[model samples]
Target chain A: MRGAILHAPGDVRFETRDDPEIIDNTDAIIRMSATCVCGSDLWDYRGINPVSEPAPIGHEYVGVVEAVGSEVTTIRPGQFVIGSFFASDGTCPHCQAGYQTSCQHREFVGAGGAQAEALRVPLADGTLVATPEIPSDELLPSLLAASDVLGTGWYAAVAAGVQPGSTVAVVGDGAVGLLGVLAAKQLGAERIIAMSRHEPRQRLAREFGASDIVTERGDEGVARIMDLTRGVGADAVLECVGTPESMQQALRSTRPGGGVGIVGVPHGVSIDGEQLFYSHVRVQGGPAPVRRFLPELVELILNGEINPGKVFDLDLPLSEVAEGYAAMDERRAIKTLLRP
Target chain B: MRGAILHAPGDVRFETRDDPEIIDNTDAIIRMSATCVCGSDLWDYRGINPVSEPAPIGHEYVGVVEAVGSEVTTIRPGQFVIGSFFASDGTCPHCQAGYQTSCQHREFVGAGGAQAEALRVPLADGTLVATPEIPSDELLPSLLAASDVLGTGWYAAVAAGVQPGSTVAVVGDGAVGLLGVLAAKQLGAERIIAMSRHEPRQRLAREFGASDIVTERGDEGVARIMDLTRGVGADAVLECVGTPESMQQALRSTRPGGGVGIVGVPHGVSIDGEQLFYSHVRVQGGPAPVRRFLPELVELILNGEINPGKVFDLDLPLSEVAEGYAAMDERRAIKTLLRP
Candidate 1:
């Protein structure tokens, strides 16, 4: 089996590796049918995040279970399923409370490597949600998105407390941001503001039910949002970009007593506590517990109520995983889908 | 009229000042019956905060309405009332949303120099909440507590999302922190953890409803909270101290998905975005909208449901205003009340 590995920053290679095997009573091996490069992957590719070892590259996937251990009672061989970015026991106190990312026995699937032909997933019974049957080829991309990006965007919206007739503002234009617009729309938001200067992404945002578009940066962006909201600011803000500037903009774009739901992976950023405290804003964000929303997102995708797969702009064979990384890093592709 | 004046960091003098009169159509002149020294007042006294000009020092008070402007129809002379540290118009969008401290036309009563014989309160119709009748001498201290400390503590508990059977931790043991224990208990918190090192304050905290007292500082404090909760941490943490250490401890003491309601006036604090992001905690704080909870706090005090006034340990005449400030600064009293 061949898998994508990062030799170092800016270098992705696909090489032969031994096929993964069931290592524990709760383990199962999945034959990957589809996978993709996430926005977070660009961090390592761009060398913004150091890659000390030749690490596995992707975390989002939809596949067919090839083998399962005796302890895996809910899933069996040959069944189609979607796995979350974070593998949760799904029955811990935290997971049961809908915080699978903080699950007591949680594991980051891709940290050990997920961009491979056959991937071994632990906690199979609680981590993988099996679909009714094999999904159609056209449904694969959307179902795969339900594993991470779509569910994360949905979590961001839910954390921001978006409700019927809410006015929402999204701070980033990445795939996750686009999905956030879709989620806010699905949650019955009356107005969705997308902040983007990129034309292609703006088109997708509009397609995803954005009510307005603002091409401003920092203070200018906040001004645009305030103007759109009659100076009261948006009822909720989705902070999809984790930079200090983006977070500050998100904080500034929300009205006092409003909420800012953050889903971006925060880098080394510091916020003035005095400003945050006086803002009278409620902030809730962390790693999205994608598993918490996976089942529902899977159902929504299968029903055709949403088309999150529209974020994928490039597709390639697993052998060319390097090109997928390059294209995404170069902004030539919003997302890359790999066929194994 | 004699008022408390801070001429410099270490120089608080009792001096004569012009009697205040209604300056706006919505203003009212109140003859203060009682006022108290706040922990925040020590910020300037200790030279941690600057005292640029001679400023009036007290922000907490309860009194009788001496005069009312033409536009003040809701409140009239002879009515006994309790008001917040800040006077709010109470008609702004923020006020309507229950964050009156961030009200667009809000005015800090302390900055207006309320530690005087008579003070002019702005937005009288919305700022002053009248009691059924004149509170007796026994109820004066409690009603005065409702003016700021008790109200702020109540806001902290409410913001922390305290539930009937939840565990809560308070990270300050000043008058406000001690009152937070009272507030948490009133909200039905099952176990109240008060972080304090002072013997007197700790005893008061337990009396006020602290089920546990941990004198540990910094990381050790976090360890104690985790140990108490079997490693998960408290469901809620109320940050009554504004220092960076207190903020960090508050964040660390709360479990993932819990709340941290901070009312401390953040001075030189800076928060690491990534740290807070990974915590998956909800935070809401600022200049507490004490006015929003003033009505309820007054009712609670009047009904004898709580004794937050017990935080005051010294009583002095209005002419001895300097002594009141000195007593709190010297740690000779938890709080000093001045009768005008």
Candidate 2:
């Protein structure tokens, strides 16, 4: 099998590796059908996040089950499936509460790696959501997104309480944020303000249903949102950037009694309790429970309700995985799809 | 008129003050029937929060309306009324959205000095809720409690998303926290856990419907809560303590996807975003919009559905107001009510 590994900062290598097998009774091996580069991956690639050792690095995948362990009952070989970044036992108290990311028995897929020809998935019955039929090439990208980004964006909208007539503001123009715009639109937000300085991403945001755009950042961004909403601020805000400034902007851009759903991985972020308390802005989100939304999102994609796959602007063969990482790191691609 | 003024730390003196009158068109003059010391007032009284100058300091009050400005129509003279610490126009977007504390036209009642013999309440028509009728001595305390502590506690329960059959935990042993125990019980929470070491307060908590009590503080407190909830934590937690430790315990004590409603006035508290993000605890709350709940709460008190005024364990004459602050400060009284 060929897999991508991060040996150190700014280093990604595609090399031959032993094929994965079902090691645990609840495990299953999947032949990767598609995978993609994520904004989070850039953290390790840019060396901002120290790389301690060489390890498999992708966690999103839409693949076909190649084999299953003796204990697996629900999922079988030859089925196309989308799985969450973290595997969760469906029976845990947290999982039952629709917060699978915090499940008592949860496992991250980073160790197994999605950017590989084949991968082993633990708790296959609980983690994998199987598609009803073989999907067309046109539908594959969207299903692949349902594995992480799209579901995450959907979770952000839900967490922010984007209601039918809500005015939403999205912070960050990454694939996830743009997808959040789409999610807010689908959820019936009357107006969506997307904050993005980049022209290309701004266009993508508009296509995903942004009613307005604020190219400014920091305090200026909050000013723009307040100006747009007649000094009241947006009713719901989606925070897709985890920086301290972005977090503040998101909090400041929301109206009193509104909510800010943060999906970005926080990096050295600290929020003042006094400001948050006085603002009355609710906050709720974590590593999205993608598994919880897979069923509905899969249906939405099958019905052509959303075109989130447009976020993938670059595609490359599995052997050229380094170029895929480089394209995203260099900001040349919004998201890069890898064919295994 | 006479009022209680904090000339300096630990120095509260009852002194003569100019009589309050209906200065604004929307203002109403109220002859004080009762006022009480608050937890937040302790910040200035204990010298933890610096007092810039000598000023009359008290905000919670329930009194008889003595006169009204030309613009005031809904409320009449001789009516018994209760108003929040903050006066609001009630027509602002925030007020309409049930966040009257953040109303566009809002004024702090601290300047009017509820502790004085007379108070001029701005936004009289919006800020004050008139009782159905003059109450007996037994009912005056409960109606007065509805002015601040009870309303604040009810908001905490609502913000925490307390529901039928839900498990709730209150983090403070103060008046607000004890009232929160009562609010949780009234809101149909199946189990209420009160964190308090004080025997009298614990008795009050149990009477207010606390099913369990945890006396430990900080990390040990979190551990005890986790132990009680089968290591999963409660479904809703009311954060009545504003310290970083109390805030973290509130977050840690709530189950994943659960909410923590913080009503305590925060002082020098900062929360790490990364910890909050990964914990999957939802947080929402600010200064309670007591005016929003006035209608139902007024009815509840009139019918004796609750008795939140029991939190006030000491009574003081207007001249002995110094003892009122001392009682709460020295932990000799849970709360002190003052009569003019």
Candidate 3:
């Protein structure tokens, strides 16, 4: 099997690798149907995040289960499944409380483009949510989206406490941010301001139900949001970018008694507590409990309520996986989907 | 009129001052019946917070309305009133949203202590919530407690999202923290943990419905809380101390999907966003919206649902107010109530 591997910072290669096999009683193996390069993948590839050694890369995948171990009761071979970046047992105390990202038996699905030709999944019954049937070919990209980005955006909106008639602001215009616009809309937010400078992504944001778009960055962006809401700020702010500036912008865009749901993968960020205290804005965000929202997002996509597959700007064969990474790293793509 | 003034750090003195008179159409002149020294007052008194000049001090008060301006219709002359430290125009957006402390036209009553024999209150009709009639002599202490400490604790518990059958933790052992234990119990939290070391406070916490007491501080305290909850941590944590250690401990003690309500006046504190992100804890705290909870707290006290007055350990005449500050600053008293 061929997969993408990160040898070091700036060194991503497509290479042949041994096929994965079911190892544990609760494990299952899947033949990858489709995979994608994540915005987070750029962290290691661009060397912003130091890659200590050659490491397995991808965590998002929509694939066909090919084999299952003895204890795997829910998922069976030949079923279509969508898996999240974080694999959760789905029945732990945390999972039961609907925080699967923080599940007691949680594990990161970081294997060298495990979403390539074949992949091994642990905690199979809990981590994988199978669709009713093998999804039609036309529904593949959207189903693949439920694996991470859409589920993550849904979590961000829910964490931000977006409600009917809420005025929401989304920071960052990546796939996650765009989908956050959709999520907030679906959650009944009356107004959504998407902060984006990119033309293509902003178009998708508008299509995703953003009522307005502010091209300003950082403080100016926050000022725009405040202005839009009559200087009171938005009721909910979705922070999808994990930078200090983005975090500050998100916090500033929310009114007192509002909330900021931060879904960004924070690297190293410090928040001034005094400012937060004075802002009176609630903060709640973490790794998206993707598994918690996977079922609903799958339904939304399957039922045609949201078409998040529009985020895919570049698509290619699994053999040209290197190009997919390059297009995203060089800012030519919003998201790159790889057909394996 | 006579009032208490902070001439310098550790230098509180009684001084003669001009009598307060109605300053606006909505203002009222109050003859103070009682005022109390707060834990926050010690911050500036100890020189930890900067003070440029001899500042008029004290914010908590229970008084009889001596005079009412034309616009003060709800409160009239001779009515006993319990007012929050911050006087808010109850009709403002923030006040209507239950964050009266951040009201657009907020007046800090303690900027110059209501501890004075006579004081002017702004927005009297809104700031002062009146009893049906002047309370009996025995209810004075308890009603005075509702002016700030008890109301603030109720705000913290509400902000923490403590629910019936939930396990809650109080992160400070001061008057507010002790009252928070009572509020949590009243709010129907199944288990209340008070983080305290002082014998007197521990006893008060127990009496106020604290089911467990963790004497450790910082990380050790968090560990103890986790141990008490069988390693799942508390469902809600009330942060009544604004210091970094207490704030972090409060954050750490909450479960992954729990809430932390912070009421302590934040000084100089910074939190690592990554740690907060990974923890998946919701953070909501700021100046207590005491005015919003004042009505309910008054009912609770009136009905004997709680007895927050027990937190007052020292009582002094208004003339000996300096002694009240000394008692609290030296940690010899949990709270000091001064009768004017």
Poorest lDDT segment (10 consecutive residues) of candidate 2 chain A: A15-24
Q: Candidate 2 docking: what grade?
A: high
TM-score of 2: 0.99
TM-score of chain B of 3: 0.98
- Per-residue lDDT of B191-267 in model 3, one digit per residue for the tens? 99999989989999999999999999877888899899988889999999999888889999999999999889878
TM-scores of the models, in the given order?
0.98, 0.99, 0.98
Please say which candidate is ahead in TM-score: 1 or 2. Answer: 2
For each candidate, what's the DockQ?
A: 0.78, 0.89, 0.77
Model 3 has a DockQ score of: 0.77
| lDDT score for residue B221 of model 1 | 94
Candidate 3: tens digits of C-alpha lDDT, residues A145-226:
8888998898899999999999999999999999999999999999999999999988999999999999998777877887
For residues B1-340, could you state the per-residue lDDT of candidate 1 as single tens digits? 8998999987888898888878899999999999888899999888899778887788888889999999998998999988988888988888888888888899888876878888889999889999999989999999999888988888888888789998999999999999989999999999999999999999999999999999998989999999999888899999999999999999999988889998888988898888988888888888878888888888888898888889989999988878888888888899999998
Judged by whole-model lDDT over C-alpha atoms, candidate 3 comes out at: 0.89
lDDT of 2 at A309: 95
Q: Report residue A214 deviation for candidate 1 (angstroms).
A: 0.8
Clash pairs detected, candidate 1: none
Q: How high is the lDDT of residue A4 in model 1? A: 92
